[model samples]
Target: MVMGIQQVSLSADGHRAAVVSLRDGVPSIYLIKNPFERRLVSDTLAPTVWAQRRLRQVPRLAPALALASEALRQRNPFLRDASYTTPPAGPLLAASEPAGSNGTNGHGEAPDSTRYGTLRVDFRNYVFSSAFDEARPPRATPSYYSSDPFAPKDNVDENGRYRPRRYRLYFTPDLVYGAAGYDMLYGVQSVTQMMFSDMLGNHRIWAATNLLVDLRNSDYLIAYSYLPRRTDWTVAVYHVARLLPDYALRTLYRYRHYGLNLSASYPLNKFERFDFGLAYMGVNQTDIGNLARPPVTRTLFYPSITYTRDVSVPGLLAPIGGHRLALQLSGSPGNLLYGRQIRFVTLLADARTYTSFGRGLYSFAFRLAGGASFGPNPQLFYSAGVENWINRRFDSFPIEDLTDFVFATPVLPLRATDINTLKGPYFGLFNAEFRFPLVAALLPGPLPILPLYNLQGTAFLDAGAVWGSPSNRRLNLFRRDEHGRQVLDDLRVAGGLGLRTIILGFPFRFDFAWPFDGRRFLHRRFYFSVGLDF
Candidate 1:
């Protein structure tokens, strides 16, 4: 909005209308009276001063005066005289003073004291535009104003909204070289956001050079995002993830196999969604030696679906029951295709729920989760014992034959035992956690300190094992001597506790756990890691 003199007409009972000239735009309260007409007038000389005082944001004269005085002293050396330097004035005097104390402002004296009140205006305008190219060479465009010329008002709508005009330019002689790597990606992405009729739309295209890389091993990925104007859904695609060079980072590390995966997730409701995808992997060698057979290639199609619902219970758990129950179930079935020896299928299932309590000084929260995974593996079981290097307790078992049981092939009803082969196809996972506020009360003020510190702890247990079947597995956990007698135990369990300190917007986590039966398993012990057992 622009500010100017709203009105300058005389009031109904005006006595000169209380006019006061502001030499420096500093307003003053004036009480006017015309004795000849016996009229009385009183008003605040400037309404702007009242608003400025409320914010206390107006720049002060002291700093500017100090800077100017210093500059002037450096040029003339005479102002350094203590008698010539001016001292600071009181606030009242500074607010209601004229620009000069001498006869005139360096020019001359005042004119006849009666013609008109010269009101000084502090006018400012803010103009914002991104269309104009600031980098254009000066010679390319004729210069009119020494400063940037104001945007042409005619190009804007009557209501002042700029009709966006996108401009594109390309330059040659550009050294456009690029590279890519795994997880870390750097590339250029182009996108546009626009409003069409009553809809909002967005489109994006991103190309990454190194999706994965090594001199001998590298990959590239191309992805894009799109949102149409008619629906409340977004579509994304990872068009490609191609390997470029191999054996780049670790020449010693073998390239088991790398492939592509494509998946899409669409929200079914506020609390439910579904995803589907497929991934293919080819391994020429296990972590050990390359197989006598060239290389095994497996293409698996995984179709997954899930449902979620929130259950809210009131006034049942705490002083202020902020309890909610959430449920989720998802599954994936994978198939491996190689030689006539097609492997058994794999399936997984998971579920979890949580509740929150309290609101004031002391708050609490609790959560629980459980999941199971069963898969077939002809090779040794790919599982390792925990190792806590940060805490100095390292207990990791060397690789060994893992398959020790065998049962049968799976059926439609999907009994747990159906997939439990002596090799792999196992199941086990459990988790629970709780949170508590560590503060007693907040300070008294408009901006009060909340529970700046909080304490959270968790207890968890995990157990996994395989069954017996046609999937011939090694007998590591339960081995039989040449006499065919049971010679080893089979069950393993672990329990752990976690202490978390939430401070200043960050969480510090420390966890410690011990085996219920801390004994030797395959000549190695088990220990907790950075608290992330999983």
Candidate 2:
């Protein structure tokens, strides 16, 4: 297994022969005429390379000349003559033609004769790395040469067969330090994350933490994943906590919890996958004001399954085309693992489609999402507000009793309203947004002070509804009627304009909306959130 000639094949015409050689154990092909025989008329050997080399690439003289002319005119006051002040040429493919009607080139007086332009080389290794990086412990290392580098090579192995992938060491793929926070909820938080994986990404390890200003509120997480075969397995553990202040009741609350989780993800194909998870967590909610009182405590065991299909084309600011769908079934069942009183079953579906206007990134996005709960202890759901919103504000209908429901479901982004504006057992939502970029191709990249990217504008509409059994008088969808009974309202709708940008590697979003029903025209709602627009 040397980096030298391995095999050879000859054409029927005895004038030429095809050579199979190895470079660092990888194979390549070369052709030579009259093998094993050489005849040179001159006594001295020729130069190995007589001219500059290029690999299927060429340069033109027009742009360089145009640039030189413009530079000369701009810096010299004597160049005010119309004959010397022509603008530079526009961007175009490379050509040898002269710029701006200059019929003659710098060497116009030279005699018209042909000579070698360059040494056009087809070094296949430059096209791509050696397909074979590993070979059965080679005896020794040897060099190789090729004339027809484009010719394909054969991997007969002296005895015909194939090779397999070999194991590789881990390398760092993600390492970052960034800021994280929402206005009133999490004030000026910071997060750091690191991840390492093998060359093929078949194995990985991740460690992340959010250690805030107050050490008591620190959160830590670590995980390991193995995906060498058909199934991907992940094991994770976390110790996370949060502290909240309430000025109204003159109380400070702390939600201290820890959890361990295991999951397996199996790819059905390239665009679809199945994920199954089992997790356990212990919750502790304490009111600091009354230390003598026992904190609200609960233990839960969760088992879930999800199916997702994503076939989206990535764009600068967002997906330009295709769609994604995710359907999930999850439950916290009593006695399934540990907690005896915990019981709930939840089903959710989320679908999104992004369609661009031809090749231009005039992205039009639409999303539909819904969820439902079953069993006596069904999970609570919330509606309204963006994710990780800052400078938070609430409308006249202030949300109440959100502490118990906040952990039950993720915030459904319903701009024009505050976080947890509505809560219920079931809810559905629809969203549509038209996004266009301002100099998207010319990116707004990172600066020394702040990292920023992907600036785009959006026009959007959001509509959603949340409701449950009329008997549940505590639900936000239930309002007192003339007869003092609970009644449900029609769909809540909002239309708005928005902007999207990424700062500190986070998708920072801003939205302003008005009540689409026209009843609240004067009331304009503004939201600043940290997340991509759905």
Candidate 3:
């Protein structure tokens, strides 16, 4: 059966409902008390339905709402301007100007839009501009300026060139230690030097003083040197007391000299010069036993011309590649000056060359030096050793404990022979060496713990000979001809291998040499020394 409900009503007891309806196309009314009470029940459900719909939409609306809230909080004006569609990606412009301000184009017109310019914001930087000036061109700032308008500055002379400062002081210490056979010598030699230019407030005058002291030998030399700047002339007053080396290895002597010297030098070019000197020297020689020799007071004049040329690549401990040449001519005229007692003339030449094989890793070096004295012999040049020693013992005594000793003269090296075994007025010497890197080249990484690096190996050869002057041929003890003329027989020769490396920025060497000529009856020698090269 189908029924259409026209009206519905709740029962007064709240347990039954009734409906008046037309059923089966008939108008009929019926009432059921408590009908469907247990099976169907209804209550208000609109609020529950609305809450379910809101729960379904929460995920989509939450994030958008949060973003809107943030935008409202920030409220950036740039975002509000629709014309500024693209946000700035970098730093903003620091300055802005009106359309007709000074910051405009060359025609004094502003840009089409509001233009911006960059500005550095450092306190130490300054910007100067002539933008306000319309008629004149801008000026640039200068990098330098003189503090005084009328006086020179920064060591600049009147000619606009730099000159050396007027005052200087320097002090250097030299220490040497060596052992030969059973003899050892060690000492500290210090030199204190002071220089003053523009003496008496005159730029043409200069003065210098050098004082050298040997702590171990009790020897000293003081020299006062004065120079006339315009003329290249120098005058020196000096006093010296020092030992003179005697070729007789078993004996020693001393010399005391005081003198006044006048010298003039002129530079021919960058690498050559001529020097002339006049001196009045008073000399007294004394033996180790305090026995005095006849005194000789002399006034001597000498002139020398020296030419030197050097082209070298410098290295940490030594030069890697280059060559040097020097030639000198010097003469002491015996009777040219009053009270002159000796006369001599000398010519000297020296040449040295260095070659690198592998970009500073390996090198070959050689030196050739020769000198000859003619006329009269005033002083003898001794050869047999390479360097001067502060103390050299005749016997096998310990240098540290020995007290009864005398200062020895400066010894020039002729290497590969015993000390004080040769003396003469003429000499020629040659030296050659091969140097190569050793351990340092083989290692791959740095060694932080040790100061030693760049270990090097060396092989060397040294040869030299000395002879007396023609007038003093009888003093040539080494070799003589049938007519008693001095001969260059029995040339001294030595060959050796060595190790070299730097320690604490200083170069050190150890060498083992064997003499080939045996002129001094010396055997193999091992030497430990300090220096850049041989």
Candidate 4:
């Protein structure tokens, strides 16, 4: 009954199957489900059949204007083959058209034929998708001229590394480029990070720099990674300027720093990875107004190890399911190795879990993180604002970074507060959020705007506390504040709703929040940020 099978595809669960067969010297498609039920999909079936299909039909590779424009083809020349006048057969992914929808849409069964719209920006997704191309399976692999020639018809570079014209176009490339995007924090930085890798992922390069927004301040960083086999090794060099604000002491400290780092990561199994890192950074303190403080400078050496368990799956906008846990221990032993007197050990734990309701349209996310340190200078915690907050405003609050501004934690989502306002040595934070998709479809025609797919809404709640003030060297939880209240009674709690969408190829979010202390709500707060949720 099934002797002339051309191709067969099985479902992951092995309960469903799609079979392609030759019937009367023509290809046909069929589907089989549980109970051994075979259903005919297309074999001259109904009013629209394969017999009426054109022999040679072209897909809508671009938008209507681009395909119709003579100027565009003259410029691109290669795109001249994209114009399709005759109607083609049904799309491979489409189901049977609705009762009246098939007659007007001659090319395919898509509603309004909106699936062929082009993108405005390249979103280089760094997670889930391997930064490098995957190992090809055993098959007749053919190399095509997919990239546009930088010079007339020359796609190969002097170094022989081929780069694809489209960043998302993955192939056996010599050098593929990626964008990690800019994170804009007002008065801090609008920094950009770029990433690149070879097709097989044997090599990777990273570069980061200030956008020259400030003529007086600048930062530069570069790194290279060898990611062949199971173990990955990376080396990095950096020059940066940092400002530290001590709200308790009512002073601002500035430092210029330089460093070199070496790191390695290896996967332990399918769900876990281990990491080791060593770095040396030096700092020079300068520019104090009024107070004639002596110029202070320090150098330190840091060695760290981390264990991570990540089983989460990628979603349209973020991770949708499973959980992840990371434990890290870092220490700066200037006294032992560099003989500079800076010494400390720090420990941290972070955990995240996500659950999807259905089809990635709705999901729940949860996170819990905490850390502590030992020795003369411990890890300073800056418990303020939300992560990647844009135009973040702060008041004169105390934040003492005794670790030479290194190993500082910027805890987030503590709303009804300004940045650098909260002061502490030890801290804990927890967040629960529900994300729901709004519009998850493509638009018709060529549009100037970045297609808004997977627009999402979020409802979240955050609870966090920072204790152990440096002045008293005592846990603030049991001690009374100047208000004659226990410090633990002032736990920070905030809840908000936000919208998320892609803009200029980056995930951007806008959030509005308010403080809720069980009794009443405080002043409303708003923030705009770029990046995904934890």
Candidate 5:
């Protein structure tokens, strides 16, 4: 029974009491801090002690906010990093940063290291992070930038894919209940029917939800539909939410008709994150009928901002990247109901980057987008395509090369009464596709419950066309075959192929497409599907 004590510290309220003399059991001291800050202070019975406590004395360089909180905990793992209790040797408080109670502060924790990025928007998602000073800026009408400045200025790709937080639930119910409640029925019955219809009765309900929170952190989408009409009864709600860790508050409501969005960000280091936003959109509709009959119209508003960027370049495969640029500017305000509107938006610069190309085993994906639409009815635009999957060669649907104009509103109409034959919006065909994947990678293994049901093949070609003419010239409004010519100015294609039936308990796929040139017989028709035709 022997014990001796000399000194022990830690009391300015950080509680600690220890003294030894009578019989061992009192000589204890604990204070652990290592392998990257793990502060522990106590009175342990010496289970092997080594003293030197100093966990984070902050002088900057916190592994880049711990790699942006480990890419938002690999896609939102709830997010947590707030603990406090320290006063011992005192002398701290002022480099403070860790706030998030709506007030939201910076850097939370959970990042050892990471890299891999590409998040740009133009097809209307609007976001163009940095200005990229390549010493270039001399065009006053078109703008969009963000092409992988090295990705990671706080990495953000809000589930366009980086995977995680993917959810979907659908339950359809139909029986019958009418009073003022459940009596739903949706539309779209066989748009070309490939078969898949019970065509249930009149009482139904549908719901959809999606959450891709934390990546860039926070994003949510919700959809709802309800019906009951023999006279009138319809309800539809759509919501979109985004808080994206740093700065962004996007909210959209489709009921009382309101939309508000705000964003702010500035990261001059790590890579780049210079966001900006200020939005206000409105819509209102009313018509309950009978009650003296008044409200027939509603309203609309717009104020926009979108500047996005998420970069990281270096790939041979598996990581080509997308959204090189996006820019938007909108204005709305009209009289006599609604008329004055303006839009100057440019997206997916460098032809809508959907780039994906692999060697060694083969892979490919493509895209196209050109721009123009200035002020009161100005037009000029474009689109192209390409997408291939090696082990599965030959499939189609890329045909896109467009030019606009020929509108009468109230649901699209080819209008032109002269203005020099309104030779405005030219160009044609805006969509195309091609794919081929025969035999599940030439299979060699797995086939019990038939897991790798090999051989998957396809061949295809499709088309689109639109170029204008017809001011006082009406050849019966268009479309004529059998040598009568004038088939909406021409340019239409469609090819065929089949047998991709790799079925089992059912991951199911069965497609058949055929439609060569055009004109009646629905134009060389033949189509069936479950999935993957192109």
Candidate 6:
């Protein structure tokens, strides 16, 4: 009586349940009521029920237990308490057991914990923060890798297959031969050029000679030029013997000049530059097949200054956009600076504008140029045909027979008229052109064998006039035609179509032009030449 349970225990056989009670302050041991039945049921069903519950929780508990074990092993403070609440799960159990178990092999002793707790990490520091800085390991500049159309590629190896030589020489031949009406016309022209660096004490030197022979005339031009490294100055000496064609008078005039020239250029900015030059020349002239005029000889000193501003996008053959303006003043005096023969002052101004359309697929360009000469001497300015490095086309039959040909001059093209037919002391010219891509735009495929892929097409109109000096009455070439109209009233005008292409690093052009100023289309002219700017 008056019994209370103090402790409960199970027998070693697990088949009996026992309870210890304090009955009247005296400890007493007693078997639990129906101990055998309870033990039998517990032993048979308890293990299976516990196993089913644990299997259900294994998936959810595995990650948490693994994380806690990892944290304890790594000495992480956040999960240490949770990891200690239960023996570490799975394989980590042995390593995370009680310190006594970890310390010894059935013996009390401390083991090495330092080896398990240490952590090592490797870090890197940045060497550069911006792309513009030179790459520390040595690399090419940004411009060398740029694909911008306007970027310069002076040092870029475009093909990566060939390297250029330090010095080179080039030669070009421009020859023409034809026969018309019992006249066997023939011309042989050639230009031989040699260029080398450091030829004369760290200066670049270029030596060239041009030789031309025709049925009625022959000429030779020799020039030697020098340019110092990293400078804009040029020194040259040249000798030239040329034949001037007179279409009006149907005669050839011999002109000769040998000169030494020194010139320098200064760039004001990216778009503007100034040029100055001085020259001393010995000149001679002889009128051939005509006795009306005597041969004239003179020594001339020429000094010139020019200012140019170009804000144009350069193309393979010409400018595609923007404008350019040039102003020049040149004086040739007989008794000024070291001369005693001819005296005159000349002023010239030229301007050009280019407009693009259709996303640069086409362009319209216009140019205006004028020049005036003053003094008592008969300074000649011819207006008739275009400018060219080599005149491959034949001149009018009578004026320039198989034996005679025209030389290059300051004369600008009038397109519609004959060469050297209009001459005076003052002249002006205007030219307009519409240019578009030809083969490049149409085909646009790589053709290693065909160099004509760079062809460009153009339609152009040219008009110009020359007039006599206002002060000289006798030298006035502007007179009335048979219709009592001023000759100046009938300005020379012409229109034509042309094709341009590049060959051997130079631009070559072929033009078929017809004069519209009272001339039949049958008299149209064909010209083949080399030049970029019209």
- Assess each prediction's global lDDT (C-alpha) against the native: 0.35, 0.66, 0.54, 0.67, 0.31, 0.60
Local distance difference test, candidate 3 = 0.54
RMSD of each: 16.9, 15.1, 34.5, 14.8, 29.2, 31.1
User: Runs in model 1 with CA error above 4 Å?
Assistant: 1-100, 103-201, 205-220, 229-252, 280-300, 306-345, 358-423, 437-455, 459-491, 502-508, 518-534
Model 2 TM-score relative to the real fold: 0.62
Output the lDDT of residue 532, model 3: 59
Q: Candidate 4: where is the Cα deviation over 4 Å?
A: 1-217, 242-254, 288-294, 335-340, 397-404, 439-453, 472-490
lDDT by residue (tens digit), candidate 6, 1-534: 435677889877776778888876889888765565654423332222223233432222333344345645446422332334343222121233344555341223223211222432212232556766555566455553355544545644677644454553433332323321111122334455655554344445566655556522333333343444334777787766666566777787776666688888888888998999998766666788675887665666779999999998777667889999999998766645552456677788999999888778689999999888787554566554655624433333322221112211345656665555665667888999999988763332676553455788899988887767344434343457687765534367778999888765667778888876442343677766666764
Off by over 4 Å in 5: 1-206, 214-226, 231-233, 241-459, 465-499, 502-534
Off by more than 4 A, model 6: 1-188, 199-202, 210-231, 243-255, 285-297, 335-340, 389-408, 441-451, 469-490, 502-506, 518-525
Evaluation by TM-score, superior candidate among 3 and 5: 3
User: Per-candidate TM vs. native?
Assistant: 0.43, 0.62, 0.51, 0.61, 0.22, 0.51
Clashing pairs in 3: 245-409, 385-413, 385-414, 386-413
Flag the better candidate by lDDT, 2 or 3.
2
Q: Candidate 1 local accuracy as lDDT?
A: 0.35
lDDT of 5 by residue, 1-534 (tens): 334555544445544444334345655544322312435574343211011113322223233233345555334312212112221132221123443344222232222211122322122333666667655785543122235444423344575544333233434444222211110011111111011112332223333333344322222222222223322222323333221111122322111233444444444444444444444433332222232534222233333444445453433212244434444443333222463343333221222233334431222323332223344433332212111111121121111111121111010011111012123223222222233345563343565454445444434344433233234222232466678865533343445554454444322333343433344323333332233321
Q: Which residue pairs collide, candidate 2?
A: none
Ranking by TM-score: 2, 4, 6, 3, 1, 5
lDDT of 2 at 415: 68
- Candidate 4: lDDT of 500? 91
**lDDT, candidate 4, at 83:** 34
**Per-residue lDDT of model 1, residues 1-534, tens digit only:** 112333344556665554444434554434446524763364333223323334343333322233355656434322221112242221111112233566432223232121112532221232566556776655543332234455443457789787765543322221234432111011232222222221222543344343334422333444443445322232322222222121333212233334455545565666454544444433322221323434333433333444434343332222222333333322223344433232433344444444554543233333333233344443223223322222231122211221111112121111111122223344333434343444334344677655533454555454434433244433345566576765433334445555555444434455554444324323222232222212
| Candidate with more favorable, higher TM-score: 2 or 6 | 2
Structure candidate 6, residue pairs in collision = 215-402, 215-403, 216-403, 216-404, 217-403, 334-339, 385-413
